[model samples]
Target: MARRRASNEELAGLVQGEQTDAVRRLEDRVAARVLGDLESRFAVLSQRSITAWVAAFGSVQAESGDTAALRRILSTIRGAVRRLLGPLGPRAQRELDQALTDAVLLGARQHAAFVEEATGRATRPVSGRPSRGLRRRAAAIGAAIADRRDRALAILRPSRARRWSDVQAGIGAAQSALPATRAHIATTVNEAVNEASLTAIDHQGAQKLWIAERDACVNCAAYSGMVVAADADFPAGLSWDPNQRGRGKALAAPPKHPHCRCRVTAWEEGWAPEGVPSFPDSLRREARRSIARGWSLPTESGAARIRAARELLRTGAGLPKSVEEFAALAVRAGRFTDRTVPTGP
Candidate 1:
């Protein structure tokens, strides 16, 4: 048998250098400068654009199994935006789309990891505590409703609606997933960031950011993205001063409803990479200051993380090994497919 040639250290280093450059190229993603929301969060859009393209590719290029075909498929999707963006537009779009797609896929891999972890820890060694405060509200609401029901019965009246939409309003505090919560916060933060950055942020982009935040808040339980900050609102002109990784943005309770677990996070205009265009300090300090908020929980009984873990594992086995796999599993088990997980009535 012929002996295989070994790669020397210098060649290995050069190869590693090239690999790193290629990877960094792939990882670079920029959200559109558009002001409006895209259909979902920036991250989810990032994931979905890639997912949809990849799925389309998988469907179209089943037997050939060509890796180049995947890139080409992504190229095809990028071509449509080229009119508005030019040649480099495709690359940026590809990066954003691929990020979202990869995130979902990695999330599945984490699902499998979560399953591996689940058989051990009795409870996740997580960040925030599940609030006893939520139960207090639920009890308070339930009791008040019950008293009304009792009073009406004594008067020979029909029991008023037990399923009042407002009754479970306080349940948002019950949700405890970290990654998912982070996604929610991340989506919102991205929006606020864009608003803070772009002169004229695209409306479609803004919508996509919201969808991403909602989905993250309600779906996966990995990272608790919701670190409620001191501000409730944000203005445009976004910039960051590095250190966004462990940085915590101010969060506030959403204005929409009482049970609303929706949260908004705000960052200092210079919190990210230096030289990125920033919003006005008025946008920064005084006008529309975002606030901090409470929590996220299912209205109905939340499936234990263990159950969520089990569901993740069962579906994540082989199929595409991505969000679709999880989605398929959820569908088979009769679970709802929430694109924007931070769902509202």
Candidate 2:
């Protein structure tokens, strides 16, 4: 007896899983480089300056005046921001260009292999080069990093700080930019991978289905299992009511928002072999589970969580105990009467 060939769903799942891992590994590499750079530069700037300041002024209140020492400290902060974030953009761009190109190429090959297995016909090879659009988007991500750096500088400006405590707090806020940059790069990678994957699907002349992760946000969950022409957009919008908001505008891709890790897979009714289950249906089921759970919503605002819990409860879905208690508190606080739903971006 011959060994059985893997079904299209299985292959597509493996390809998606592998692609996710590749993106994550790339994120780790880029993040590690960034963190290393930040640590080395920040230590030189912060440790020396902080040590000098505390040695000169024994108390935080002693540095409350706009004196020469304070001026020097602010100057140090400006220098620190520049040194820390100046090279981050180009560095990230280099990593994205090389790693994303390879990852997209591998994903394209996997998608092509799926088509070949299903139809027994060799597909045209996909170009491994990152598209001009992807390059432009990656550059935009770099620019975003620069923008964050500027914002951090603004936060640490003299007008914003008086005492050592204020400067320390501002520096704390500025350091948040590092993690934000890492998150932005990771989101960009997902967007790039999906764009390349969809292009590959188009090249293979196949339809595509949106596959939301099992714990995706409500916005992304709404699009799970959506099948569309390779050239067409998925029917639902990224956020808000799918029936009322952005329909037919969102292109078939994984990320409906920042940090979205959705993926796409090829789909054809006839290509699914006998005894193979429905991939789209399985995805939809997972999506429903995500919506019902509602505890894993991405929003951090109490109002947003309460609103989500209310909606889930209205639909007769069970909520986690914490969510129920939160909603109950909002109801008691009379916040629930305010009918405005928080449509997150």
Off by over 4 Å in 2: 1-16, 39-49, 61-63, 113-125, 236-249, 274-277, 294-345
Question: In order, what lDDT does every prediction score?
Answer: 0.27, 0.64
Instruction: Give one digit per residue, the lDDT tens place, for model 1 in 62-113.
Output: 3324445444533433332222223222333333333443433332332222
Q: Could you give candidate 2's per-residue lDDT for residues 288-314 as a string of tens digits?
A: 444433434344343543454456556
Cα displacement (angstroms), candidate 1, residue 319, comes to 44
| Candidate 1 runs further than 4 Å off | 1-126, 154-252, 259-261, 266-268, 274-345
State residue 156's C-alpha deviation in candidate 2, in Å. 3.6
Worst 10 residues of 2 by lDDT: 336-345
lDDT of 1: 0.27
